[model samples]
Target: MKLQQLMSQTRRAIDDYGMIHTGDKIAIGISGGKDSLTLLYALHGLQRFYPEKFDLEAITVDLGNPDFDLSHIRHLCETMQIPYTVVKTEIAQIVFEERKEKNPCSLCAKMRKGALNDAVKKLGCNKIAYAHHKDDIVETMMMSLIYEGHFYSFPPITHLDRTNLTVIRPLMYVSEADVKGFCRKYQLPVVKSPCPADGYTKRQYVKDLLRKLNLENPGVKERMFSAIINGNISDWTPRIR
Candidate 1:
């Protein structure tokens, strides 16, 4: 998708779910990946003319991997004039080496988020933007069902009472295919994940399964997404404008 198309879908999602507010400071969690970079571009473009004025801060939680490079990401941020920060941590060594976790995604994610939240708080951001697209939402629901025997997925907006911070997913309406297309078309400085278990997790299995299901049963993914929207699962329902 082109930038114009991405911004249009992103603005619609933001408006439909009341994701943004006046004078809000949102921290975009950058993983140097396509999803997050696409989010970065979308928000930056939206900030230009959205009725509600808000500030954007780009942040990445470095997982202490030597092979994980952020030079290109930093340059992108510099060129875009978005304030960027990278929080360095030993999460990589702790999760893979020290802990020797067979399933490290869970622990790695926890540590990464914890670090990112702390940095965001220090930056005085009231909200955080996560680049979780439509496929992520559906895949997460499937994972919950198959692994935990429940039908659940994360909401577009979530308020954390403990931290007094809100998390918003602005890319909830955009598909993974569109995200890849946007990145490719824009030639985004996408960074490869250095994690050993990038594609060997249960989530990966569910993603593959979902793809097969969608192929055999057309519109299955859309129906599942519709169910989540209308299922009254937590705050999954879109807010009325």
Candidate 2:
């Protein structure tokens, strides 16, 4: 997908959820993955023309993995004139070495997001943007259903009262396939994840299962996404245009 197309979808989600406001500073959580990088590019592009003015900052929580590099990411942010900050933490050690939890994803994510949220709050950002796309939304819903016995997924916007920060997912309308295409076309500096549980998580299982189900029953993903927005689950309802 081209930058124009990405921006179009991102803008729709932003507007639909009332995500941004004039003079609002938004922080983008950079995981050094394609989804987050695509979000960075999309939001940067949208900033150029979107009527509601906002500032963008990129923040990454460094899990203290030796293989994880941020030099390329720093260069990308510098080239785009966006402020970038990486919070260094020994989360990898704590989760893998010290705690040694069998299911490390939960603990690791909590630590990572805690770090990210702290950094974002320090930066005076009222809202933080995550790169959860259409596929992620569907996968999360399926995971909740299969594991927690609930037909639910995260909302596009969530207010974390504890942190006093509102989380926004502007890429909710963009698909993972389009994210890959945009990254490839724009030659984004994609960084490979060094986490040990990269592909061994329950989400990955659900992702594969959803892919197979989609193949067997075409348009299932789209219908599921449509159902999410119209399902009246929490704040999934879209704003009237």
Candidate 3:
């Protein structure tokens, strides 16, 4: 897709969700992965001259990997002057040893989300944005349906009760391929997750499964994503738009 088309989709999501309000300080959760890095870059590109005045900062939850040199992130953040803070955690080790039987994905995501929320509160930001895109949304829907026998996926915008933080997914309309292509075009420094379960994980299996399913049924991802938006989610929340 053309860069203009990609930007248009991203812009639509941002506006549709009313994310990045004026005079707001937004913090992004960067996981050293393509999705996150792409998010950081896209936000940076938009922040250059966003009509609305706001500040952007990048935060990464370091799994405390000895091999992970965060200098790249530091450099990028410094270049953009976007306050980049790293929170060190032993969650990786804990998850591996303690949470072996249960699905580690749910726990890992919750912990990371807790950490991100804490960061938002610590930084005094009213909102937080994640890098989830079209593919992730579709895959999540598939995962939930196949395993939990339910139709559920991430929302484009949400407000948490405890912290009252607005979580927005700006790249919700963007594609994974476009993100990777944009990263390559911009030569964004790609950082690998220090998590030992990087490649050998059930999430990877689900990703592969989704891909195969899509290959068999063309437009499967597109239809699934659209269904989530236009489907009967009225019972899930009164805030359904």
Give me the candidate number with maximum lDDT: 1
What are the models' TM-scores? Answer: 0.98, 0.98, 0.89
Clashes of 1: 0
Runs with alpha carbons beyond 4 Å of true place in candidate 3: 1-6, 97-102, 235-241
lDDT, candidates in the order shown: 0.94, 0.94, 0.79
lDDT of 3 by residue, 103-122 (tens): 56667878888888898789
How many clashing residue pairs are found in candidate 3? Answer: 0
Worst ten in a row by lDDT for model 1: 232-241
- Give lDDT tens digits, candidate 2, residues 28-110: 99999999999999999999999999999999999999989899999999999999999999999999999999999989999
Tens-place lDDT per residue, model 1, 182-210, is: 99988999999999999899989999999
Worst 10 residues of 2 by lDDT: 232-241
The predicted structure with the larger lDDT, 2 or 3, is: 2
